[model samples]
Target: MGVFTYENEVASVIPLTKFFKAFIIDADNLYPKIVPNQPQTEIVEGDGGPGTIKKITFNHGGQVKIIMHRLDIVDEASLTYKYTVLEGDLISDTIDQIVKEIKVTAGPDGGSILKNTSIYHIKGDNQLDKEKLKTDEEKGLTLFKIAAGYLLTNPDEYN
Candidate 1:
C-alpha cells in the first residue's frame, strides 16, 4: 500500500459559518455543477449523515467514466468529512484497492485548510511505486485547490 498527501490553504472572503456550510453541506450536492469537467456523482444510497454511503461516477478528462461506491463516511465535526472508496472502476479496472479522505479545518487566523490523503493498494502483488502515486495525488490536489477556491468565492449558483 502507498499513501499520498496533498494540501492547500485559502483566504476566505466569506464568513466561516457560511464557508463551512457551503463546503460540508452544499458542496456535495453542487459538485457536479461546480466541477463540470468531472464525471457525474450520484448518491445511490446515503443517510446524509455519518456512516452514510453513496455511489459516485467519476468522469475522466478523456470522458472515461468510473462508478465508485462509498464505503464509509465519518462526520468528525462541523466541517470535516472523512470517507473511503469501497468499489469503483478505478478499483476494479485499474487498482485493487483504495482509500481516500479529505479534511477541512479552520486556519490559524481566518481561513481553512483542505487536506487530501489517498492510500492505494496496488494490484500487481508487487511493491508499489510511492513516487508515482504521490505525483498523481499532487496533481489532484492542485485541481482540488482550484475548485475549492472557486467555491469560497461563489458558494451559491454552483449549479
Candidate 2:
C-alpha cells in the first residue's frame, strides 16, 4: 500500500484548554448540538480513551453516510488526540485507511494553535484524489469554526 501525509495548522482565539475540551473531549456531545448539520457520534466500544471506537452518521446530499473510527491516542495532559478511520462510507475502494492526529498548543495572545496531520493509506497504485482531500480538509475546518464559535459564545461551556 502507498501512503500520503498532509499537515496543517489553524490559529484560534479560544484558549488551549477550552478549545481542546470542546473540540476533542466533548466533541461527541457538542458537535450535533452546536452544528445542526454535524454528524451524530456514538461510542460503539470501549470508553472515551484510547482504543475506543465511535460510529458517526451524517446526512450528505440527501443521503446518509456512516463512518467508524478507532481512537489511537488520547492524552489530556499534552492536548493530543489521534484516531484512525477503519471503515465508513468515506473510505473508497482505493483507500485502505485514514489516520488523523490533532494537537492543541498555547498560541500567542492567549489563543490556541491547532495542528493537524492526516495520513492516507492507499490500497493499490492509484493516485490520491486531491479534490477529495481538499473537500475533507474544508469540512474539517468548517467543523472547527463551528465549535470555536459555540465555545466563544458560551465561554463557560467547556471550562
- Off by more than 4 A, model 2: 60-64
Which one is best on lDDT? Answer: 2
lDDT of 1 by residue, 59-150 (tens): 55543356454645545465555666667555544466676666666666765666555666665555655676665566655545555667
Q: Candidate 1 overall Cα lDDT vs. reference? A: 0.57
Q: What is the C-alpha RMSD of each candidate to the true structure, in Å?
A: 4.0, 1.6
The lowest-lDDT stretch of 10 consecutive residues in candidate 1 is: 1-10
TM-score of each: 0.68, 0.93
Residue 122 error, candidate 2, Å: 0.4
Best by TM-score: 2
**What is the Å distance of residue 139 in model 1 from its true position?**
2.5
What clash pairs does model 1 have? 39-59
Which stretches of candidate 1 lie above 4 Å from their native place? 1-19, 76-78, 92-94, 122-124, 155-159
